[model samples]
Target: MTEKKDSPSFEETLSELDAIVSEMENGDLPLEVALGKFERGVALSRLGQQSLEQAEQKVKILVNEQGENQLHTLPENEQP
Candidate 1:
């Protein structure tokens, strides 16, 4: 049994998902094992999606200020 870890890194989750895909594609695993892998893959996919959404929310672009570019923070509800 694999021990569950708290808050696995995005890369780790992605790698696990890829491995699950490969295993399923091979078509040699027992139904129980395959179903378990599929379930874990779904969980990892959800976590990855959430991580991406959070990153998108926090994304920012830096502009050079030498000429006239200015930095500003927008309200969360006003983000474009």
Candidate 2:
């Protein structure tokens, strides 16, 4: 089979995570299947977190000529 692309986008990963949670909560999956789903969910969570962190690092904050505070790229450690 052809290689798949890199990990899903943040929004897509989050959607998959939500689906996994709903599936787990429904209590219908076999033990093995549930475990697999849980593992995949964890991976997706990590991907989402990493994406957010990268975006944050690229963020910038600036003050306009009018002396109003404006948000540019966000710092990795600080929220916009």
Best by TM-score: 2
Q: What is the lDDT of candidate 2?
A: 0.81
TM-score of each: 0.67, 0.68
Model 2 residue 43 lDDT score: 93
TM-score of 1: 0.67
Give the count of colliding residue pairs in each prediction: 0, 5
Least accurate 10 contiguous residues by lDDT in model 2: 57-66
Give the alpha carbon lDDT tens digit for every residue of 1-80 in model 2: 22248768788999999999999999999999999999999999998898887775445222344465665567888964
CA lDDT for candidate 1: 0.81
Residue pairs with backbone atoms closer than 3 Å in model 2 (clashes): 59-73, 59-74, 60-72, 60-73, 60-74
| lDDT (Cα, 0-100) at 35 in candidate 1 | 95
Q: What is candidate 1's lDDT per residue for 1-80, written digit by digit as tens? A: 24357889889989989999999999999999999999999999999998887665444222342443555789999999
